[model samples]
Target: MFDDVIQEDVLLEMKYVYDYVKIETAFPKYATKKALQKYSSPTLLFAAENDVFFPSKLIVPRSEQIFSNLTKTVILQNSSHMQNNANINKILTEIEYFFSN
Candidate 1:
């Protein structure tokens, strides 16, 4: 899908793409600990145990401390960034439970 979009767009400039990539690379610098610490709303974080991009060990603790309101963190075992059908169902069940209570 992404490849098709890139291929079809004749006017897509390389400079614009480079700039976007540069901004994305620098996102963590602006989206800092202090920024996360300001969150006060209830949050449910589903962390994939095997996800390299957002590791559960690092994110869970920081999230717990950051959110002033009730924060629930579920570490889905044997799951990657893109969850399987079973894991997706599990997440839906968790969301339903979270909302009901």
Candidate 2:
């Protein structure tokens, strides 16, 4: 099996996350004050200004209030959840900037 082929210690574990899943599933459990207080870290919460599922007007402020340590926020003025060319480029730039310093 794939798990056996690579040594557990040698293989880095990564999980693909869908934002909708967080909103629907995890949020109910983890979006409480106690949960936020438990896991405090530097966070970069990005929201699309034009996102249909999660608009920046809502998500940005909510994230800022919830996360104990929010490093930055970059909202693409005219973007959606799909991360189109303009949004992708903007996000990529923010990511590069985040890791550089």
Candidate 3:
């Protein structure tokens, strides 16, 4: 009975994701290599210094290589994958600066 309930939950979740993806397909999807070659717009990368999901060290250099028009990288010091209010404020500030400049 428990297994059946779990399977139903999983199927429901999968259907939700599939529906969401179908709706999202209206936007352009770019492969990393293709985006690197094709994209030529200014871009800013805000990286959390202490992010567990995506380490700054790995993401920074890889982004630098990929983004032809890379503008800047703002490192949010002592931050993790899930940001606090302070981090959100910092991110907003960085975005404002990026757009203004």
Q: Could you say which candidate leads in lDDT?
A: 3
**Could you arrange the candidates by lDDT from highest to lowest?**
3, 1, 2
Query: Could you tell which candidate, 1 or 3, scores higher by lDDT?
Result: 3
lDDT of 1 at 46: 91
lDDT (Cα, tens digit) per residue for candidate 2, span 1-101: 12123434433331223422353443343375567797866677788777776789988878877887889988877666655555567788888888887
Q: How high is the lDDT of residue 98 in model 2?
A: 89
Off by over 4 Å in 2: 1-30
lDDT measured at residue 71 in model 3 versus the true structure, 0 to 100: 92
What TM-score would candidate 2 get against the native?
A: 0.65
For model 1, which pairs clash? none
Worst 10 residues of 2 by lDDT: 1-10
**Candidate 3, after superposition: displacement of residue 66 in Å?**
1.0
Candidate 1 lDDT over residue span 18-50, tens digit each? 667655553264244577666666778898877
| Model with the higher lDDT, candidate 2 or 3 | 3
Q: What TM-scores do the predictions have?
A: 0.63, 0.65, 0.65
Q: What are the RMSD figures for all models against the true structure?
A: 7.1, 10.7, 9.1
Model 1 poorest ten-residue lDDT run: 1-10
Alpha carbon deviation, residue 78, candidate 1 (Å): 1.3
